[model samples]
Each structure stands twice: as structure tokens, then as C-alpha cells.
Target: MQFANQTGGNDFTLQGLLNSADTSVPLFFAFLCIFLVTISGNVIILTVVTMDRSLQTPMYFFLSNLSFLEIWYTMTIVPKLLANLIIKSNNISFSGCMAQLFFFVTFGATECYLLLVMAYDRYLAICKPLYYSSLMDTSTCLQLVAGSWVTGVLTGLIPVLFISHLNFCASRHVNHFYCDIPPLLELSCSNIYLTEISIFILSLVVLFSCLLLTLVSYVFIVNSILQIKSNSSRNRTFSTCGAHLTVVLIYYGTMIFMYVRPHSSYSSDLKKFISVFYTVVTPGLNPIIYSLRNKEVKMSVKKIAHRVLPSGFKKTQKNVKSIF
Candidate 1:
């Protein structure tokens, strides 16, 4: 396969979701809608958490950070994806591809750490209720959030540095929507044994380590909940974790399937679908999941809605005055 412009240039042509022009318009609109929803949902979550004093707790603080990460994560890939759907030539500059790979990995890994942190926060809240407040104070929460970002950036940087030195000889078509490590590695002309091993090891260290911590935290959380005498009390405590658990299941489920396995086993089409689901779909669904399931978030949304809608607030006030 004669790679396009392989003489001296490093430009890559992305073989996006569907190569046919007939499907482009529909796919473009579909992804456009997904992008808008992803942006709007995460933005609202971030806005509501920032504006509402009621949501000024450790849980929501972590949530806001997650929202912030999701927004950037979606932006890193989806816009380019949408463009690829519409445009025939999905040529991305070498530097642009590297930048995309960097941010995509950064946000993706950051989310892993953030989710783990959120799990630990939930564990502390449920298992150690008496000390939850003192232990997860504002400073501590900030530190955790900061640590996740730092860790993600560092972890993501390692792979990018290794991949940068790789030589791509002929085939420049990346068989995915984004610059994922596996596909990028597949395109390398250099002997990728060390690179593949390094990526696998790094992925295991980052993804599985976080997964283990999250599981351990939840195990203790479940144990503590089981000891509760009142069913209502146990249910209420469990409800607080319901949203995070749902997100973790979706996020980790797609991620582990994509990254945890050997690159040789990855079917290009299947990996593309999975990537879209996690990168595009999950971020959009996260705010919806939290808002629908978490009563606290729902209540906060209503409170903000009331504050925003004058007519509704007036009617509510009139009802209250009549009752008085």
C-alpha cells in the first residue's frame, strides 16, 4: 500500500467511520447532534455545580471536575470526527495528529483517575459518615482533583513521547476516528515490539490500577451498607452512589474492552464503534444519568430552574402566599 505523501511528510489520512459519501450527511448530522448534547450536558453540569451553593460539596466538586474533563475529551475527537464525516479528504497534519493524541489520552486517563477519586469519595461518605466532612474537606478535595489532572498528563505524555520517535513508512491510513495508541502503533514502520509492550503495560498500570481501587472502595461501601439496620437508610445511602456506579460501569466497560487487550485482537470496525460510544456517547450520557438518578442533582437543577424562570418562581411564591 503506497502511503500518500510518505516521502518526507508525516501527514496522515484518517479512515473515518464510513468512507462512502452517501452516508456522510446523515452521519454528520447524527454526530453533530451528539456533539451538541455532549457540550450542553457537561456545560450545564459544570455551570449548575459552580453556581449553586447547595452543590458545593466534595461529591459535586469532583463531578464538576469530571464535567470539565468530559467537555475537553469530547472536543478533542468529535469535532475532527464530524469534519471527517463531511469532508472527503480527512487529512490531518502530523503535528495536529500528535496534539489530538496527546489531549485525547490526557483526558481519557484523567477521567480514569477522577472516577477512582469519586469512588473513594463515595466510599468515605458511606463507610465513614461521621468523619466524611472532616476527612473530605475543601482543601483535600482540591488536592485530589489536582492530583488526577497531574497524573493523567504525566501518564499520557509517556506514550506520546515513545510514539513520536516511531517512523511511519507507507500506510498512513488510521483505521479509527481518532488517533488512538493502538492504531497509531499499527501504522508505525519501526519495530513496535517495545512500543506495544510499553503501551500495554502503561494501560494496565493506569486503567487496571484505577479499576482495582474503585472496586475495593465499592466493596467496602457495600459491606458498610449491609450492616445498616434500616432498609430506608441503606437505600438512601446506596442511592447516593447509584449515579457514579452507573457512569463507572459504562466508562470502564468500554475502556477496558478497548485498551486492556492486545492490539492484534482489535477489529478496526469494532474498535471504532467502541471508541465512539465511550468518547462521544458516554460524555453526553453522564450528566443525564446523574441528573435523572441523583435526587440531589435533580433538586439542584430545579432550584436553578426556579431561580432562572421568573414566571415559575412568581407562581410558586403566589402558591406559598396563599397557603400562608
Candidate 2:
């Protein structure tokens, strides 16, 4: 159903990554590959973590949560994007747009909180090793995960609910691949001062606050690592935290630049590229970044492969021998 726009309609058209017919097929295949990798990688992480008793620690638990989140996070936008590319019609109903905005924001914010929780987990593990198990018990881990989801939902709801009521009498064409806060605000004909202010405040509170907490945790972590007299211990500690730090830099760098700025400052083309980076590229890279560099994850994957492959190979050999 169409909502009222400038021309008195509810349907909004998304201006996807590229509009040329020549590029559509290539873009579709490219994104399809990325999407598949994103899903499969995350699924592998989840499966490995769940199956292996060795991966049942606080660290792997959070890594599994992140992998699970990335699956949904990528799902929210990439399918529609793939559809838009093939069909060449970017029209999304008002309800669909709002729904997309809701889930996208929810997952993104939830990730921020989850990353912070992970940082704290690492801090406890490194800085206060003796009490790590006691402090980050099963109950605490569950609560932190629960809190991140709840906070993400609540935070995401505020902007969408507010934006949904605004009059989009200016235009129905959104200049990005997805329904994001800045693009939606740009479409509003109504006075957006209060809305912008609210969003800015929320950004500072939600995004910056979590970033600050993560930084503080890392500070303590670094200090603890420096205190270790053994070079091997120091190297080991750096290796463990390095993956998370790499992810943090990439995710936060794009996100903060996109969301924390004034709506007027948005350059549609630049924002679109940045949006693609965070939404599409980052999700696919997360599992690789976290797993390829991680010895534990690599070990877990090898163990699972051995467990599953050898039995299947034996059965196949038995069938071949019987046939011969």
C-alpha cells in the first residue's frame, strides 16, 4: 500500500548502487557471491562453535553471537538489493521501507553493543585473568547478550517511529540502496530540526558511548599485556585481541562517518559507497577476519572436518568395494 508522498503516494523508490543495464548483471553476480559467502561463513562459525566443546568459552560464545548477527544483518539488505539489481525496479512500499529501517538499525546498534561486550570480555580475560571465569560466568554472558539485543531494539525504534510520522511531501526517491536515517531525513518536507537533534543525541549516546567503553577496555588490556615480562606471552595476547581490533576499526570508521554527520552534509554518492562497505563488505569479511586469523577457530574447523569427513569417506569406500 502506498503512503502519501509529494505526489500523494506511499511507495518509495530506492536508487540502488548502479542504474545502468550493462552493469546490472555483473553487480548482481558480485553481490550474490558476497551474500553467499557471508551466510556460509557465519553458518560455519555458528556450527563449529556449537559442536565443539572446546569452543564453549565466553570468547567463542560472543563470536558465535556476532556470526549469527552478521547473517541477519546482511540478510536485511542484500536480498532486496539483489532483487533490485535483477528486476531493475527499486520501488519499496512504505511499510517495507520502515521495516527495513527498523531491522537494519536494530542489528547495527546491537552489533555495537555486542562488540563492546566482547571488548569487556577480553579485558577481563587479559587484565584480570585469575577472576575471569568468576566474573564472566554463563549468567553474565547471557545477560550481556540479552542487554545488547534489548538496547538495540529500543534504540532503533525511536528513530523509525519518529521518521514514519514525518511528511515526505518533498520526494519519494531515496538516493541510497537502503532506508537509512540520513536519507529518510532528507526526504522529509517537515521541519527536521528536532528530529535531527534527537538523532544526533542518540548517536552520541549509543555509538560514541559504546566506542568509548571499548577504548577504555582496550586501554586496560594494553597495560596488562605490557606488564607481561615474557615476549611470547605478549605476542600471544596481541594475536588474540588483534582480530577484534581490526573489525572494530573497519566497522566503526564507516558507521560513525555515515550516521554521526548532519543530514545536509550527506553526499549521496559517497554515502552510497560507504553504505555498501559497512552493510555488504563488512558482513562478509567479519567471519574471515575473525576466523582466518584465529588459531582456535581454525583448530575447531579442522576437528569438525576430521570428525565428519573420515566416516563419510569410509562409508564411500565400503560401497565401492561392495560394487567391485
Candidate 3:
């Protein structure tokens, strides 16, 4: 496949996923469905969490933040991905590419920290139930959310700073779907030793550190659950944490494999496959996972659906009558 011109000094061409005519149509529609579902599902999660009085606890508050982040996180990449599928010679300006990279990394790191916070939240709730409310009060929850965002922004910014300054005299055709760090680094003509080391160190420090802490929190959580006398209560306590742990495992597993490895180990096909999982598949699946597993969220969703469907049907009926 012929790539875009290298003549445009500030533009990099992306060899997007499944550019073949036979697969493009099906892939585009599939991703469109996923994108729509991802957006609508997360929106429902946000609305339900906000409206449900019973879900006003610290756990649901963090969940709402997660839903909010998922919306923007999916938004950052999916639209461009859809466009790239249709528009074969997908070229992005240097600034636009950098912006996309920044937001993607920022959201990614924010998710890591947020998951850590959620794990810690569970730790407190299960291991120290008596002090849970006082320790994770409204003020403290807001501060934790704010800190995660701030930390993500800074983490994303530093990598972009290093990347933007690098000389891109090599070919401008990136062999991946979006502006990921690995592909962009591969395209750079400059000395990338420093850039690679810095990013690798950051990824290790940020991703693994969070992973380690989350594991420790879960260790304590499991121990606390085991100590409970009643089997039903023990199962109930473990149930509350099941969804978060599932999400954490899926998200962290894909991300660590993608970002933490050496540059020489990069495989274009493997990278693309992994990217689709975290970026498209995970976002679409997250709300479903959380809502399906949590009884309260299901009840809240049913309440919202009941409240919305009638009004929507009425509007459709009125429009039909006016047309007639």
C-alpha cells in the first residue's frame, strides 16, 4: 500500500488498521457500534451514579469518575480510528498527533491511578470498615480524584516534551492506527536512547508501582474477607470487589505489555491487536461489566430506563401524529 507523501514537513501519515476494502466496511461498522455503545453505556453509568441516592458512597463516587474518564478516553481515539478506516491515506499534523498522544497517555495514566485509588477504597471499606467513612469522606475523595488527574497530566506532558523535540527525519509513515508512543518513536531519526530510557523508566514507575500497590491492597482485602465467620457475608464482601478487580486485570495486563517493554521487542501486528483491546474493546466492555455485576447499578439502570423510554416514546408518537 502506498503511503502519504513525506513532502509535508509537519505531517505524519498513519497506516490505519484494516485498510483493505474487503475488511474496511465490516470493521468500520463494528467499531461504530462499539463506539456508540461505549459512549452511551458510560453516559448511562454516569447518570445513574449521579441520580441514585443509594450510590452516593465513596465507591460509587470513584466509579462515576471512572465512567467520566472512559467517555473522554474512548473519544480521543475512536473517532480518528473510524476516520482512518475510511480515509486510507490518513495524515495527521505534528501538533494534532502530539495532542492525541498527550490526551491518550494522560487518560491511561489517570486510569492507573484511579484504579489504585479504587483498590485502596476497597481496602479501607473491607479491612477497616469502622473507619471507612471517616477516612474516605467527601473532601478526601475529591482530593484523590483531583490528584490523579494532575499526576496524569504531568506524566503525559513529560513524555510529549521529549518526543516533540526529537528529529523525525526518518519516514513519516507510522505503521499503526493512532499516535501511540511506540510507533512514533520508531519513526524518529534522532538518537532515541534517551527517549526510550526515559519512557521505559516512567512506564515502570507509573504502571508497575500502581500495579504493586493495587496487589498489596487486594492481598489485605482477601485476608480480611477470609476472617469473616459467615459464608454469605464473606461472599458478599468479595462480590463487591469482583468487578473492579476484573477491570484492573484486563486494563493493566494490556497496558503493561504495550508500554513497558523494550523498543526492540515491538511487533506491529501484536501492538495493533493489543491497542484495539485496551482502546476499543475495554471501554465498550467496562460499563457492561460493572453494571451487570453490581445489583445496585442494575436497579438504577432499570429506574433510568423506565424514566426515559416513556418520554422518548411519547416524543415519537407526537412526531408521528404531526406528520400524519
Residue-level lDDT tens digits of model 1 in 1-324: 344343365688889987678988998998899889778777877878888898888988998898889889999999888888876658987778888989988999999999899889989988898999999998999999999999999988988899888888577888888788888888887888888888888888888899889989988998998899999988887776666677788888888888776655656888888888888888888776655356676666667767888669867655434422
Q: Per-residue lDDT for 96 in model 3?
A: 87
1-324 per-residue lDDT for model 3 (tens digits) = 223333355688889985478888789899999999889878877888888898888988998898899999999999999998776649889888899999999999998999899889989998898999899999999999999999999999988999888777547878889999988888877788999989999999999999999999999999998999999998886776676687788888999898887665666887898889999998888777765457787766666655768668656545433422
TM-score of each: 0.89, 0.90, 0.89
Candidate 3: lDDT of 169? 57
Worst 10 residues of 2 by lDDT: 1-10
For model 1 the local lDDT of residue 56 reads: 88
Q: lDDT scores for all predictions?
A: 0.82, 0.85, 0.85
lDDT of 2 by residue, 1-324 (tens): 233553344688999986678988998999999999899888988998999999899988998999999999999999999998998779988888999999998999999999999999989998888999999999999999999999999988999888987888536889788888888887888888899989888887888899889989998998988899999989987876776687787888888888786555656788888888889999988888776557687667667766778767656545433422
Segments in model 3 whose C-alpha atoms lie over 4 Å from true places: 1-9, 236-240, 305-324
Give lDDT: candidate 2, residue 298: 68
Residue 135 of model 2 has an lDDT of 99
